[model samples]
Target chain A: MVENYNDVKTINTFEIKERSYFSILWGRFKKNKMAVISLYFIIFLIVVAIVGPLVSPYHYTMMDYTALYQTPNAKHWMGTDDGGRDLATLIVYGLRNALIVGFGAGLVEVFIGILIGAIAGYLGGQVDNILMRFVDIMFALPSFLLNLVLVVVLGRSLFTILLAIGLTSWAGMARLVRGQVLTVKQLEYIEAAKALGASNLTIILRYVIPNSVGPIAVALSFNIPGAMMMESGLSLIGLGVMPPMPSWGGLISQGSRWMLSYPHMILFPAGAFALTILAFTFFGDGLRDAFDPKTE
Target chain B: MAQNILQVENVKKYFKVGKKDLKAVDGVSFALEKHKSLGIVGESGSGKSTLARLILGLIPPTEGDVYLLGKSIFKASKNEVKQLRREIQMVFQNPYLSLFPHMTIGSNIEEPLRLHNIGTKKTRKSIVLNLMEQVGVPPQYYNSFPHELSGGQQQRVAIARALALEPQLIVFDEPVSSLDVSIQAQILNLLLELKRKTDLSYIFIAHDLAVVEYVSDLIAVMYLGVFVEFASTEELLNEPLHPYTQTLLKSVPVIGGEIRDITISGEIPSPINPPSGCPFHPRCPYKKEICEIEKPILKEVKPEHNVACHLY
Candidate 1:
């Protein structure tokens, strides 16, 4: 029997070395060239935002009253806006604000969404009915309109802005979480957990949450750009980062007052908004592809 | 009287279909004794799996009670029912889908121990290793994911997971039907060996009479949400009663050149508008005039054998 066990040992060994989950996922994600390109662009953009001030020699809010609206050049590359501040510094500051709102608000929404959805979905009947109804009510409301109203009521502070965005954004995240939770909660592993005398709390936290990280992570990635856009939109309408505290949106908002006379002002800010959204979109695609079973 | 461990009392599960209600498991009943096997054989819509699910309390019945070790499982408090959960674990059809992909083989086995708060993490780790050895997975596979193992290996891991709590009873829902024939034999033998060591009782639900006959102490034949025949495996095979049971036996295709009329006329009717008296009347070939009007209650034709047919 011992001598004949060679085949079993060999077969077992072969199975043990087939592939790791992370490796399989990573391999699949890397195959998508566009997602890779997006990942690079997003990372580069983040790094640029962090190191913007050290690389450039200008305080964004510093006024050069005499040199207001200067054209693009080496000294004041990409030109100045109506406020006579460095356009470069404004873009960087805007980049920082955009990322902050995008990620900060996103984290809040996803955390709340997962908690609510997981509980609601796992514990069906009355609990599911009640929670889903709340989610539906929120989902039925126009998020953009809600954000607009919230900003008006709360006034324009960074905390208030993130809070408003997070509050408005979580409805969609919650719906996605609830759907994933419903499907995963029914999986045999979860049933096994319950059969093992695992408590509802233990099952949700241990099995359901970890298993759901794929979709949740993907959803978070997709939501960031949307949050950034919302931030940019609010700032453009003067409900975001207040005047003299330069943002790409605030800068462009000011520059747009002069319209065709100073087209660079509108162009640069719009370009920043488009670039940020595009990069995030690609990064999101990479993450979505990464979690798929067939990717590897 | 027969050292009965669990008794399923007139269980009924119904779901709303549009405006009307559809009875899934309608007034089904059975009983099992400790350290014995009960085989539940049925077609896809025959509600065998649903009965298994109800017995396991994965889903509460629309109307019925499952007594585990003679304690009401469905009506029990959360804490009380948890005891039943630990006592009665389950092995599923697809082991690959049953085991958590994110978890390692060891962690998967340690779950029940952690849930029941039986032992500390350190001791539970040892128990997991012991379980792994019992099921033939080595210590090296402890850190491996579900996707790393073959179908047979994965099934073993799933079995180890069910065995983690050292439960008295295991509800195996077609545990071997998902694998290759050779692998099925190995798993079946493993299950028998496990029963020997622990004296574990099993409610083995399967589609194959051949496989069920190999592993069962008692067999119950179900058709369209009800049992038509139930007896000891040997007796049920040798002296089969009920038309449905006969048809099912005929359908059993072996490796040899054996051929029989496994094929019965007409489809199993929808449970919503079941053939007035007997649910099996449409597909049941032995149907007489009385078969269409009044349902035949299960009557014991022998000391422990029961059959529910007009002919019986």
Candidate 2:
């Protein structure tokens, strides 16, 4: 170990560079080749969602009566749905909406989870008891049933679906964060931070959150896909985003009607949906492995 | 007279374990003067670490108060408490655990300075580098995480961190216990050198008698949440009044000396249900009749020496 240290010292004689936590995490994340590919694919999907509409041959709502039900022909790639809408354009818009809902709900869960978890874990006693009990109640509620009730009550809309999924999904996140916080808070450095005169907020934000990032990152990676799946499930039940505004779930649901007769209808959207889900799942699994504190 | 930098006034911390209350640091009181060092030596369950936390105001004492430069830390308001933290700092026991895993060694040392808004970015960097140098850590390790460094190097970083605030008193809780014997000496020597070069006082807690004697001017022998003996290091080592202290001193392995076949028999009594009186009486070799029924308070037996035993 001593010899290794000296060797590194000699190699970097004059250039003293600071390696960030993210850089190190990225380095670890890159080790898993599939995860790297999935990350790139997810990024590519996001990019497509952003610009695919502007560059596509037809608008998502544009219907070509003459070229209706065509499959993968030149100029009309990915065919057309039953409504004669360009399936490629529809899928682009669907990907955009799916990404939004997935990322939006994931952000909500992370924000709320870190807040409640850090508070309950750091401030033990009555505050902990009350907050954790509330979390327990949240846990006890049937998440799917609650999501269903919320979607019905709020009336089907993009924002409502995101909110419902976010609200229902955060309980697990809160519990996970709280557990992480509990363990990290007990570490000696936290007390050392306290002794060094860091405020409660500083300790929570700077010390606590950074240390607990591993688990939280893993949880968030899974939550994005989980949110997407929940939104898709809602759309599958016919109460997702309204028509015109294409969502991946709504597109797949619309396609499933012509199951045997027009396999093309289900084939395109379903394949995209499954691929995206698989990408996120693989990415999340890779993240879980990367951030597994035991590895390092 | 020397200034009293820190004072713990009968500070008691009780933790509820199931039905009974675990008296972790029951009515432990001591005063550390500026530029002086007080070593607290004890076994694992003796609450030495708990007492260190109470002194640092990391945890509030269930009863009594800890004073920093004559101001009570527990009673201080939120802002005032923060201000007091600048005057007191602590180096935790485990070197590996004392540093943030994510941050670089340089950043770890600079954190206390950053938290207090002590200097500009440029100045903080220079201060961190200077501190790293002072603690004998290599400046090239500035960007290295805690895991990359050896245990001794990590401890140096931790010490550098504690020193950044320039606190008057730093409480070291078994800072060298986790290091190898050779590394322990190096760290201890660094601490001694630092102590010599500064006006900083210390509350050094350790289980090792030799290490405590090497670094401390005054030493307190703790047993089951209370001090059984307190005196100057020389006085305590030369003429230990309490039987427990005597056993502890005799047990320290000596070079080229007879190996005394002496050990404290039986387990330390549970803090939740401590012995009725003289917490060490059950394991003490020289226990009197009065030692079992009534508890003895720390009373001065000799000039500047205190013992909490009936025999004293």
What is the C-alpha local distance difference test score of each model?
0.84, 0.88
Candidate 2 per-residue C-alpha lDDT over A75-190 given as tens digits, one digit per residue, 9 for 90 to 100: 87888877788998998898988999999999888988888988888898899899999999999999889999999999888998898889888888888888988998888888
What is the fnat score of candidate 2?
A: 0.82
Steric clash pairs (candidate 2): none
Runs of candidate 1 with Cα error greater than 4 angstroms are A1-24, A33-58, A64-84, A115-142, A255-272, B18-21, B138-140, B254-264, B281-290, B310-312
Cα lDDT of model 2 by residue, B56-171, tens digit: 88888999888899999988998898889888889988978978888888889999999888999999999999999999998889988898889999999999999999989989
Q: Highest TM-score, which number? A: 2
Estimate TM-scores for all models. Answer: 0.87, 0.95
Question: How accurate locally is residue B36 in candidate 1, as Cα lDDT from 0 to 100?
Answer: 93
Tens-digit lDDT string for candidate 1 (B134-210): 99887788878788789999999999989887788899999998999999999999988988888899989998899
Classify candidate 1 by CAPRI docking class. Answer: acceptable
For candidate 2, the C-alpha RMSD (Å) to the true structure equals 2.5
